[model samples]
Target: MAEKITIFAHVRNICKASIFRICPPCLAALSRILARFHSNTQRQLVLFLNTAHFLTIGVSLALVVAFFLYAVDGRPIKGEDSFASEESEEFLPNVREIVGEIRPGDSLSSSFRSNGVDEEVRESVISAFDGVMNFREMKPNDRYTLTLDNDGTLIKCLYESGPLEVHAIERTPEGSLAAKKLDVALDCRTVKLRGRIESSLFAALAAFKEDAKLVYTFADIFASKIDFNTETRFGDTFELVVEKYYKNNEFVGYGKILVARYNSKEVGPLEGFYFDQGGKSAYFDHRGYELGESFIRSPVPMARVSSGFSYNRRHPVLDIVRPHLGVDLAAPMGTPIMATSDGRVRFAGWKGGYGKQIILDHGGGYQTYYGHLSRFAN
Candidate 1:
């Protein structure tokens, strides 16, 4: 009875909505029939709405899931992935070969042959290097390195001659070559050294661990007039400007002595000048006089001033006191002595008490003689 009553109430609510309106008896009978149909239509409408909403939500969720999986699997969309991959491939470097350093004294042909480089390639690289570096001037033990690209074009060529000078050659975009000069910037240094007369000039300057080559060069420049060993006073001072090479903030090596001033105790201020004149480089004095004179004084390079000029000196072999005419440069028996002045070979034979001697008559009464020579110079 309760179920029948609830169904009748639901039918009254559905039919009252103007779907049916008629007389009392007829309306009452039709109302029961229409109520039954209206109740059945309500149930079907509720089921259809729930099924349609479920299908819409399920299809939306599946589309979202499929998009996530496709992104993760790296599928190409609009072919963007393939185009990106091809772009990366274009930038990859194509290495042709690896070559080692070309040491000095290595012929171009031999060096390239060892590195598996062809003759034509070697000739091209050599031609490029010649424009910047003089290959003939290369010394033994100098360093050189080479590299190539995919098209057999030289990529990089590095050459190191000294601590300061380096040559770098690289290819340009126009398929030509370019050169860069990388000279280690020189560090200027001014130092003052003073000492008493010692065993040798090098020994006196030993307090400063200077470049021996530079010191020797300095001595040679002033060897003609100033005698560092004999003529140097006890309080003589030397001021010099030495060029040093510093790499990565550490001292590596030295260049030429750019400027040097030696105030000799006896002689006045002696200065050395290095200048480039008419595209040629040379050393000279402030007066433009070339530092290279006609002749260097001492034949033997600064071993020592063994003996000085004297009127009476006992001979070692003769064991008798005699007037030594010229300065006795006591060196090893085999040491070659040079001619102090440039003159014709007026005398190059044996003389009394002067064994195997050479006498160069420099005109006037001033003639230089080198005695006890192992071999006469040509």
Candidate 2:
């Protein structure tokens, strides 16, 4: 009876374990039993290796697919290349053939249309001259010629007649475009000015009530050879005749001074004239001899008046009357100061109150002095 009871208990335990599905010890025992079913250990090791190999291959394939996608879609970064060819063919410049006169009141569009120009070419030509020429003001009988390309583009536009010369450019092969140029041709003119001396050069020039421009012209022409303040006597007089330029009744610029006559109260009258010798223009005396004066009177060379001539002005050290003999030409420093006449340097060194002076001995008791010099001329 006890043996029978043990068998029944074993059967009951197995049924309970199966029903609950929780048999840790049984499962462990089953593993051992299954391990025994394999004939060799090598087979178990082979199974382990197969599982690891599949995992590695799957991960590798995923990485390869990611890399492939990146390579196919990614773009490289490049720098700006201004010299590269443009992609748009529409941006290319157009050159066309044009013959006939473009006049005021003429339709640029209709005219080009009559000439069998393409719509694109006509639009391009009109756009090129849009802000430049007034196409609405064009008159009949006006002569003009244009050469265009298949696209009806203009390369050059020219209008001949009147005070200005016009040149218009529409297209270029390179990436550069230029606006048209209007070269002006002004008429020539004559100008004159007169003045009387009173104590100084600029004061006398101001008395003329002439245009400041005219005075500047007069001074520039004569400054190289004449010293207005010292060399000019108290009762001197100056007269000048010159040539100027005008465009459309407007003053453009001044030319050469035709003639100048200066009469000094003490010094003899000096007459100067401009002459073209061997293709070079120069100021010469009435006798046709070159005025070989060493330097121009004013450093500015323009006709502006000098500041003043003061003796007791202000000596940093002395601070008293030093008797400033020559006039003070308030010009930009380093301006050239020329000798009045051809003479030897009597004294070219520092004088007590003169700072730095150059005294020229004209001989026979005549002498001229220049002080506070930046340098000495050779």
Candidate 3:
């Protein structure tokens, strides 16, 4: 009687185990097979493995069901990728594009709210794109577009303030926002420009009815040869064959300066031609010597020099003669000061007479110092 009771228990356990994996008919068939096993070791081992295999099959089938439910919706899971990425595709179809420019008292959030966009979606776009673009950098008259689908759901956005600052933001089918920077379309033409400096190189470029961009390009070409800020005379002359960029018939900026000629009385006449061989592009002098300035001449190109770098110099404020290692620049208080060279900051903050200063270590014993700064750039 005890052995018969044990057989019934084994049969009941087998039926319960395979219930989910098999139908009721299959369970009954399995139960009839288990009733013949008794306590036979071979039959008992076979039944144990058979049930274990069905259990694995059960787990697999459950996973397949879950996969089918989600596979119908074709999208990467939310955590699978980041919010924004650089994309090459420029346009999307079946959408109505609403274009607008940023107004004086407008924000991205307020603009979206006025357009009836969902608050949750607007916040997601802001959060996703905040790292790519700063709210403070969004100036008045910056252009933006909203591409809505047939259902009036926002599918894409394009925003631009400058030639190189076009941002394309799009929403995926998964309701995730994707962002990318689009390249600007510009017409490049090699043009010749001739100008004479009346006050400074910057002023000369402005007087020529050209963008201030040409000043930097021309300066960069002859940076090592001449200091346009200090050495430039009123009669200094310049001629250049350069590439200028234009978008929609409006001047955007300047590109590569192919040929440059400068005749300054202090530095004499100097010429440089752009040469690109094998993938390296560089400026070459008339004698074919590569030209590049390792050091910038001035810390402030626009500011006038209040005092020169000197030894045994008379201090204006202290009324005492002392060694003044760094030059003094005359600029308005809180004016931005840029680094003359690239380096890691070895020191930043106050240093007594220097006030707020920054010391940059440019690898080798080459260290540059910026003194009396109003604030540090982030």
Candidate 4:
């Protein structure tokens, strides 16, 4: 019995050693299979949730698009249908404005015809301006404005001939046009202009932005005392109290020189004040002396004395030394020569050496001779 027990115990010990060695690899294989199964299961669960969430978002976007299209197609835009329904609505008379300057060789009739005015309307307009304006004297560059209806019916016409004058024509109630000349009501503002003679009176005034017309008027105001042509010195200064006209805050023109003061280096300080007395306007000095002399020193305004009165002088064309009795005033060839003083024409023909001359005899012993004239005044 002892030997049998020994053999059984030895077999049992051998079987226990084999089980311990094999159990290690079998347990490791089982753990790897369980880990792989858990990884695949988690991956499938994440994919399913992501696909379901995308499907839900895509369905919501499609529904929102469908709702937008359905809402826009349900109603029509406002004001689109009202335009055709109100076809017979009376609007304010459609006014068309035409503004332009008169071109060269343009007549009033031609201007009206070219601007789509009817024949009868043109004739009516011409008749309207018959006593008001001289249609024949319409000059180029004259600005005009015509107001008309949409059907080319004339409403109002305005012709601005000068800065201060306007000719207006309006359609009357009797279907005829009536014309009237309107002097633009000017707001006279007293302005003082001071300048020193640099080169010329015109240049000095022009530097001050004075109008050319104002310059001529200023020279005329002081014509008796100051010779604007050759007597203006470099340091000569002048102050003018002038009446400048304005319309709608825009300078229109000049009215008159109220007072003028001129200080010359050649001549002394001369002053003139305009005054209205005895139903006539005249300029007077500070001492109330009348500046208007019976005879103007120069026959032509702003003309220079080319040759003064002398016993011996050389002729320009003749090239001969002779006696020059009268002052030779230099002017343009076709310049209009006015009588220096109120006198009768003594001789109005060509003289010996003078080309074309006019001899005016005053009632007194003074006789004025105007030589090198183009023609005699009527």
How well does each candidate superpose onto the true structure, as a TM-score?
Answer: 0.53, 0.38, 0.62, 0.66
- When 3 and 4 are scored with lDDT, the better candidate is 3
Stretches of candidate 1 off by over 4 Å are 1-79, 96-99, 102-105, 178-197, 233-237, 252-301, 305-378
Best by lDDT: 3
Q: lDDT for every model?
A: 0.67, 0.63, 0.76, 0.75
- Candidate 4 versus the native: TM-score? 0.66
Error of 1 at 2 (Å): 31
Clash counts per candidate, in order, are 1, 19, 0, 0
Q: Cα RMSD to native, each candidate?
A: 11.9, 26.1, 21.2, 19.1
Tens-place lDDT per residue, model 1, 1-378, is 454455545444444433234345754564355445555775564355446556766787899999889878977655777889789989998865554555556875577788788787778777877768776667656666777768776788777876666988888888787887786665654444444444456656676766566556777667676755466665556666666667766777765666666777688777777787699876777898877576675666555666677778887789899787677666557655555666766788888868887777877677777777777655
lDDT of candidate 2 at residue 377, scale 0 to 100:
62
**What's the lDDT of the predicted structure labeled candidate 2?**
0.63
Q: Which stretches of candidate 4 lie over 4 Å from their true place?
A: 1-88, 150-152, 331-338, 344-361, 369-378
- Candidate 4 lDDT, 239-261, residue by residue in tens: 99998889888988877799988
> lDDT, candidate 4, residue 161?
83
Tell me model 4's lDDT, rounded to 2 decimals.
Answer: 0.75
- After TM-score superposition, the amount by which residue 237's alpha carbon in candidate 2 deviates from its true location, in angstroms, is 2.4
> What is the TM-score ranking, best to worst?
4, 3, 1, 2
Which portions of model 2 miss their true places by more than 4 Å? 1-182, 198-209, 231-235, 298-327, 331-378
lDDT per residue for candidate 3 within 334-375, as digits (tens), equals 656656667899999999988988999988889988888888
lDDT of 2 by residue, 1-378 (tens): 453343334433443533235355764554454344434553454355456556766787899998777656743323332223334545776655567655455576776677676687567666767777766456566555666555544556554333354646545777343447576777988878777776755666667544455555565556656655457666788888878788879765667788988887665777788889799887788788766455556544432344356655565467665665566665556666656666798899998867889898877777888777877765
